[model samples]
Target: MNVSIIKYNAGNVQSVLFALERIGINAVVTDNIDKLQTADKVIFPGVGEASSAMKYLKEKKLDEVIINLKQPVLGICLGMQLMCRFSEEGETNCLGIFDNNVKLFSADLKNTKVPQIGWNTIYDLKTNLYKNIIENEYMYFVHSYFAEISENTIAKTNYGLEYSSSLQKNNFYATQFHPEKSSDAGQKILENFIKI
Candidate 1:
């Protein structure tokens, strides 16, 4: 299958491409909207500031292309954050594919740390993305901002409090964690996404 890893100021694209390569899948990485929209599957992976990333997508008109994509589109980390309607990180408007606002961890949770790093178990799972996945299974995560628990929450994870870890709304599916970096369980999650 033809897979495209979106290229708009990348940080994790190489790792994601490497992950796909390990699974024997060749993926194209590009910012060209036509290629992105026509690909069999589009993987939106990011590891950078949200506002800057959105700026780049908007420049390429990918901001609109991404929302209109019909195939299963997966967003990882910052990519997932960008899929939300708005983000507190830069008080910026986002793609609005997920219909929620992204917020920074409250300063009150100082004990919990700002950018939540490392593995955390995800529970209250609700999507087929969890087909072979079990409840409270640990996955990789490295993010400071998070999508608040909302209607589309398909999974939950803890930082200072329970928050949305994965979201699903129509053709848009996203995860706050980086499955490519999560070892075996992570691979299974990506496999599930590929099948979807």
Candidate 2:
């Protein structure tokens, strides 16, 4: 399959590439609309500012291309935030693929930390992406923003409060965590997506 990792100003592009390499899928990383739109699968993995990233996508008209894709598409971390209707990170409007709102984690999480970094266990598994992902499986995460639990949410995780860990709507799928760095469980999720 021709997997294209949408490249923009966001960070973590290389690690996504490496993750695909580990799975034996040589993916093309590009900002080109034609290449991205034509790819069998597209992964919008991000790790940076939402305002600037959305600007870049809009500037190149890649945002529309992403929303119109037919094949299975996945978003990781900031990628998931961009798929939402709006994000508090930069008070920005996103792709609106998923109707949930993204909000910043409170610094005062009782005993929890802001950004919700490190390993997190995901439960309430739904969709083919988690076909083999056992309930309560641990997935790596790193973010200050999170998606609100909603009808689109397929999985949930608890940090300070419970939040949507993974969401799905038709061909669209997103995760607030970084599966590329989540080791075996993460790989299984990616592998499930490939088959989907």
lDDT against the true structure, each candidate: 0.90, 0.91
Q: Which candidate is the best by TM-score?
A: 2
How do the residues 1-196 of candidate 2 rate in per-residue lDDT, one tens digit apiece? 8999998889698888898899999999998888988898999999999999999999989889999998889999999999999999889999999999999989888787886779989999998899978999999999999999999999999988999999999999999888899999898888888888
Clashing pairs in 2: none
Q: Tell me the spans in candidate 2 whose CA falls farther than 4 Å from its real position.
A: none
Candidate 2 similarity to native, TM-score: 0.97
Cα-based RMSD of candidate 2 = 0.9
Candidate 1 residue pairs that clash: none
| Total backbone clashes of candidate 1, pairs 3 or more residues apart or in separate chains | 0
Instruction: Quote the positional error of residue 169 for candidate 1 in Å.
Output: 0.8
Query: Tens digits of per-residue lDDT for model 1 on 66-151?
Result: 98999999999999999999999888899988888899888698478767889999999887888889899999999889999899
TM-scores of all candidate predictions against the true structure: 0.96, 0.97
Candidate 1: stretches off by over 4 Å: none
